[model samples]
Target: MIPLRQLPRLLRIAGVLARHRVDELLPASRRPRSLAWLRALMPAPGADLLVLPRGERLALALTALGPIFVKFGQILSTRRDLLPADVADALTQLQDRVAPFPAAQARAAIERAFGATIEARYASFDDAPLASASIAQVHAATLADGREVVVKVLRPDIHARIDADVALLRALAGVVERTHPSADKIRPQAIVDEIETTLVNELDLQREGANASLLRRNFAGSDDLYVPEVVWSHTSAGVLTLERVRGIPVDDLAALDAAGIDRVALAEKGVRLFYTQVFRDNFFHADAHAGNIWVDATRPADPRFIALDFGIMGSLPERDQYWLAENFLALFNQDYARIAELHVRAGWMPADARLDELEAAVRTVCEPYFTRPLSEISLAEVVVKLFEVARRHDLTLQPQLILLQKTLLNIEGVGRLLHPRIDIWATAKPVLERIWRRRSGPRAVLRTLRRRVPEWLAAAPDMPQLVHGWLSRANAGEMELRVASDDLKEIERRLRHGQRVAIWLSAGVSLAVATACVALLAPAGAPPGARWVAWLLGAAAVGAFALAARRS
Candidate 1:
């Protein structure tokens, strides 16, 4: 259920869409059957969208919905393969080109962020925004020391708006999960939670600045990619300032061509850079859309990529990184068995899962892709297919893996757009091979052992003391041991049964020997008590032997 306070925001969202005649743009199948009555609730019942195309109406409605929806459009624009060309083309307006707020508002925001006049902070601050989005607008400026930088300021009251939207999303997630039959499999709430974390992180300019600084340091001296330097002194929770870079926007093919850039090489470089970030460095800029990327065509022969918008970066745990790299290598080798084994090894699939069945499933998903030439294969499509297969096999879906898949899709779109024939697998195989070789080498084994030597040395002094304590306790008949497992318990029961039977047999044999010795060595005139004792011993031996035989 929607909260009373958030209902207004939800109504505003619906109103904007209805005002733009958004329902007219949707295909019949895309609209939910339950929401068929939405048309009756629209405010502008007579609104006509004859002047705007369906795609344009969508873009307008998204813009009116607010910044978050605009960002969604921007991301959707990257997947041209999935969207209609008209809609995808229209969404480009949202990427670093969303309609800016008033110049006065921008100025007010800057002054509010720094608590001083613009001139006092920047050598020259522009009132007009360089780019604007739902959350913030950026202004290009010159620093006091003649360094060019871009100053980003958060949108006014963005926090409250985001909070309201997030609450609405949560409410919607709950409603869908509870009411929809397939919701358990989809896990809409989990997805919403992930989105909330991402959006919340993006709201903090200080965090974004830190992200920029760390990424800059990661590729500090590299020519393949460059991360702009952050101006730490001017950065704050609501404001971020970073060194401005000049380059041709990555999507501008004409500009790249005019500048003599080698598109194929640039495309290949993108693949290498992605692998390096994900596997080698284990850190990547999750949002690598064309809007956040540029090409330094000044060095056309040696093109370099310039990255911006460091609000969302991703990294995996060390184990996942290695497993993912191995998975990639296994793909290249067409090792379906290894891939199946890897799923179990990575704890993605249950240990008892039939490897042969998993292998066959993998082959079913992947074999068709190899029939096509490597240059013609789509990396994103294959990844999607594998995800479906994973779901079928009940594999444990790792959130980090999802993040990596998203990043890969973004990268693949950018790469294919730049060079249609560039083979992603061909470019990535050697890099993964190199990483695997280094990690699996004997030197790595030695290095790991060397690192543990100090730990072993520190514990060496206690070993003898531990040994002595165990021995002393054993001698005092106070030793104790405990282990828990059904298999071990059964073995323990059998061992105990065998030990009892052995004792019983030994006692019976000893008694029998004693009884015989007493009878054989006694004199003819021996007392009746001796004879009775012998008879008693013989009878006891017979009973003991019978008990031992029954047990055995």
Candidate 2:
């Protein structure tokens, strides 16, 4: 049942739709008079024409609603294949714009969450937020020892609002599943589940703090990526304190140009950083939108990427990481057959399916881009085509792999935006090949064996006993292997019954055959009827044995 107070909000949402000429997107059964009444309350002259495009309007609407919608738009923006080009293009502009909460509120939240006063903990506290998004805002401050830091505070009562939206989405997803067959293909429920998990993780600033720490550790001693230090002493579930960062936004081409940064080199560096994260580290920043990325332009010749928003990071399973590395290398080398084989080996397709057919499909999707210059090829299109082929082959990707795919596409997009003629393969291929060789070559085998030597030594004492037990089992006719499961109970029962039938038939056939042989040898009581009976029994016994074998 719908809550009474929620009706007003729902009606207001309806009214906004009618006012903005987006009523068509809503269900048709809603009351037109109520919609008209809500539209009447809309301010005059409507929104600016520049913002009316579906994508831009979506961004504006999400921002107006708050963080939940903004986050949704961010995820949606990654799904270029599932969305219209215009809508997807516009959603790229959605930033986490939010009004910072007053300092008093920030203090109150910190106090409530940590049971301490701001002044007692820090040298000075600022009311002004360093950054604000839909769910949380960050404020700059100083520790008593004089270290600079930033505090992240969750938006007041944001969870209640987020929960409501998630519940609504869950309910709507059910309806879509029941009514639209396409919903099953797209897996709306799974998508919602991913969104829910990511949002929940982001809500806990402590998790974000830990994520930042892991990333910081991963990039330690590296010059390509910078992850800020988290102040563990002050971090909490709803609040986080970390080292403050200052850099030029990568998208600010004007600022980059003024700094005399080489746009081409910077773009290549971005691609390299991405490959390093995904292949070498297996951990990557999932959210690399322009706003979350910055260039440390202090050294124009050696520009480094400054990543923020660690709340939504990604990682792949070891198997997926290996497969992806292999896939990238295979595609770069134009090994279409290897790509097809990897898909099948990864259980992305049925074993009985025609490999030639899949190879043909891959060639069809990838052939057009072969040997083309970087400016002429669309990596994003290639990814979409791969996804389409996967769907046709009934390939269900691991969730982590999906994130990796999206992150790769996002990195490519950002790279191309910086330099239109950037060759992604040129920048990433060498890194992938090196990693692949290290992980798959003879050296890797030696390393793996070296790591396992201790365990092997520990097991050496048991080898003699293990071999003896194996030989003992081979000598004993009583030796048997059995597995138990409830699902096979009926089959087991049928097999037992069939075993008895086979035994009785075999005995009867043996008696008849012996009698026939004796009669034929003695020729004293031999008869045509007896011979016929013997032959019939022998045929019946053979048939029973065959049936029993099949049943077993």
Candidate 3:
């Protein structure tokens, strides 16, 4: 239940929705009867609004609500499969272009963050904003050393506003989870949590600066991408200062032509850079919308991408990274069986799901796309189809990967916009294959072993005691095993044999360590006592190994 403190805001939201006639979007059966009285009490929308499309009205209402709601709309826009085409299209137009707060307020925020006057910090600071967004506004400024930079200042009291709205959203999500029939599929609470995490990360400018710095370091000397340097001395949590950069917007094709830029090469580079960031570097700029991406025209023949807005960088967990890379390769190869197996092995699908059925379902959905020209196939659509198939097979989608999915869509959109004939599969396959080869090769195994051996050796001494305790407990009848079937009984038998092998191996390793210690620490002029101790340890090591070999 929503608290009394949130009731007013709840009513405000209901009123906004009603005014926009969003209730009409829902069937009468699904609409709550309780909201009827409230709708009657609220003021009606203007006639101008009544003439607008329902989707546009909804978008406008969300914009009227605040940045948090607008952000929610932005996230929803990416999931075209889940929403009506018109609604998703309308939401795609929802950009982060809100009116800027007063210059005095921005100045006050900067002063409070740094505890210094604006004049003391910069040589000249512009009062008018260069660009204004929902959470922050960017102002052009010059450093004391005459370097130009852009100063981004967070909106005043944004945290309190975000906190209050987030609490309201959580309450609403709980209500929907309890009441909505499709709550499991919608996962409203998880979506709210994702929005909250994204907002919280974006709220910290210092963290964003670090992200920009790291991305810059990763692409240092690279011809494909350029990241602006962060000005640490002038940056803080509430304010960020980055080196100023200017380039043609990536979506501006006419400008590219005017500048004699190679659009085809530029588009191919975007695809390659995206795969490099995700698979090779494992760190990618999640928000790669046109505004944040610009093309450097100075090198018209060899263009580079200038990235902006470091607030929403993304990285996958190691397991997800590997599985996703393999999944892409499987899709590229049209290996539906491998795709099905991967989904199950990655724990995305239920273990009991029949692989043959899953493979058939995937082939049905994806095989048609292959009939089309390679350039005509949309990678985003293929991913969406995979997700649809996953839903049918009881797929457990990871909340953490939503960012990567969104990034993929953005990259594809940009790539197609730059060069409609670009084959994303062809461009990305080589990058993934190269990464897979590097990661799974013999040298990689050797590197991993070198890094892990010390840790294993340090823990070797404890294994003998642990294994002995387990065996003693089993022999004492303190451990019980109940098998429900012949398969389980066979598994139990194998487990017992494995335990015995573990015990022998542990004893062997422990004795070996003791022998090594005795030999390494013994006196050079072998005193009889020290020599005997060394001999005993060596003998014990040999005996333990012999026992282990016999047990196996």
Candidate 4:
């Protein structure tokens, strides 16, 4: 049930829908009073009822709503093939800039979160925001040592607002699942779950700080990429302080051109960085849009990427990682059958799926791209189509991998914008090959043995004692045997219960028979004829129990 206090918000949402002439967006056929009543208050003018492209209108409305909605739009934009072309294009323009908060409020919130004055921690602090995003805004500041840094502050009342929105989204998802036929395909609840995970992660600035620190460690001593340094002393869940980065924004092509930077090399490095993160380190930044990327034009010929946001990231399970590496290598080698086999082996498709059929499905999606020039190839489009085909072939792709695929598409987008002719496959293939060779070759086996030899040596002293203990247990008659069965588990339970009852009843019958036999053979003994009869009766009872035992 919607809370009483939250009904007003629900009414407001309905009002927004009514004003936008989108009452059909809400399923009011079921709840006329709650949903339709609001729509009835102010009917959409006839002029407003005209149909535009569903995707574009949807994207525009989401972006206009605010930061949270804009972020949602950006996420949906990555799923181009799932959406109509016009809507995806509109959502692609949903950048992360928003109006900044006042300096007083920002400083006060930071002081309250830290329980101290900002002056004590910083030599100088600016109230003006250096940049404002949907979730948080960053302000320029200086530490006590006169080192420049940026302070990221979460928007006030964001948690409460998000909590309310999530509640509504969950309720809406439940409603859609019940009413809509395509709910199972779209997985509305799962999308909301992903959003909840990503948004909650964004709320914790300290976690983002740690992510930055790890990425910095991964790329240490490298020239292709750089991550800002997190100032541990000043970072918190609500606020983060990082070494301020000075670079031309990756999206600012004109500025980079002015700096004499090689856009082609910059684009190639982006692909290389992505592969290194995925295949080499098995860690990657999931959110890498133009706004989150910057170019260090300090060295024009050797430009390095500066990654900002780290809240949303992705990594694969080890098995998936292996299959993905093999898949990429196979694609590079034009081995579609190998790709099909990997998908089946990885349980990405049904176990009974025919290899040839799957190979054909893959070829149908990939063949068009193969004939295209590198400059004309949209890697994102290829991935989206692959997903479409995979769904048809019964592939329930992992959610984590979906995020990675979207991130890769974003990186590819940035790359294509920088240099249209860069061969992403060429850059990525060598990295995957090196990783596969290191993991699956004879040298890897030798390395593994070398690492394990010390453990083997350590166990040598205890080997004889362990053998002796096993022998001693065997001789003492204290051994236990266990049998495992999966096929007859139910039958086994029933059989064991039956045996317990049969054993008790048999013992009772045997005792009675023995007593009768003793009485018959007493001093007041039975005559010869009767004694034979008693023996016969006793034997019959014993034989009956033996039959029961055999059946059991």
Winning candidate number (TM-score): 3
Compose the digit string of candidate 3's lDDT tens values, residues 1-552.
Answer: 899999988988988888788877777888876577767887876899999987899999899898778977886776554666578768877878888889999999999989999999999999999999878999999999999999999998889988988899999999989998889888889778878888899999999999999999999999999999999999999999999999999988999999999999999999998889988889999888888999998999999999999998888899999999899999999999999999999999899999999999999999899999998999977987788778778888675465677678788989999999999988988888998899889778767755664565466566557656755665566785778999999999898788767767776775665565455544356557755654564465556545544543
State each model's CA lDDT, in order: 0.78, 0.75, 0.85, 0.77
Clash count for candidate 1 is 1
* Tens-digit per-residue lDDT, 18-114, candidate 2: 5554543334664355656665787643557334765566566666666677888777666654566667667767877777777788899999887
Candidate number with the higher TM-score (1 or 2): 2
Models 1 onward score TM values of 0.77, 0.78, 0.86, 0.78
Segments in model 4 whose C-alpha atoms lie over 4 Å from true places: 17-52, 76-89, 442-552
> Candidate 1, which segments miss by more than 4 Å at Cα?
12-34, 40-64, 72-97, 446-552
- Give the winner by lDDT: 2 or 3: 3
Alpha carbon lDDT at 366, candidate 1: 93
- Which 10-residue window of candidate 2 scores lowest in summed lDDT? 514-523
Which of 1 and 3 is the better model by TM-score?
A: 3
| lDDT per residue (tens digit) for residues 456-545 in model 1 | 446645644664565566556574334499888888778758766776777677565555546554546667786675566556555644
By TM-score, rank the candidates, best first. 3, 2, 4, 1
Clashing pairs in 4: 55-87, 56-87
User: By how many angstroms RMSD does model 1 differ from the true structure?
Assistant: 16.3
Q: What is the lDDT of residue 322 in candidate 4?
A: 88
Give the TM-score (vs. native) of candidate 1: 0.77
Compared with the true structure, the alpha-carbon lDDT of candidate 2 equals 0.75
lDDT winner: 3
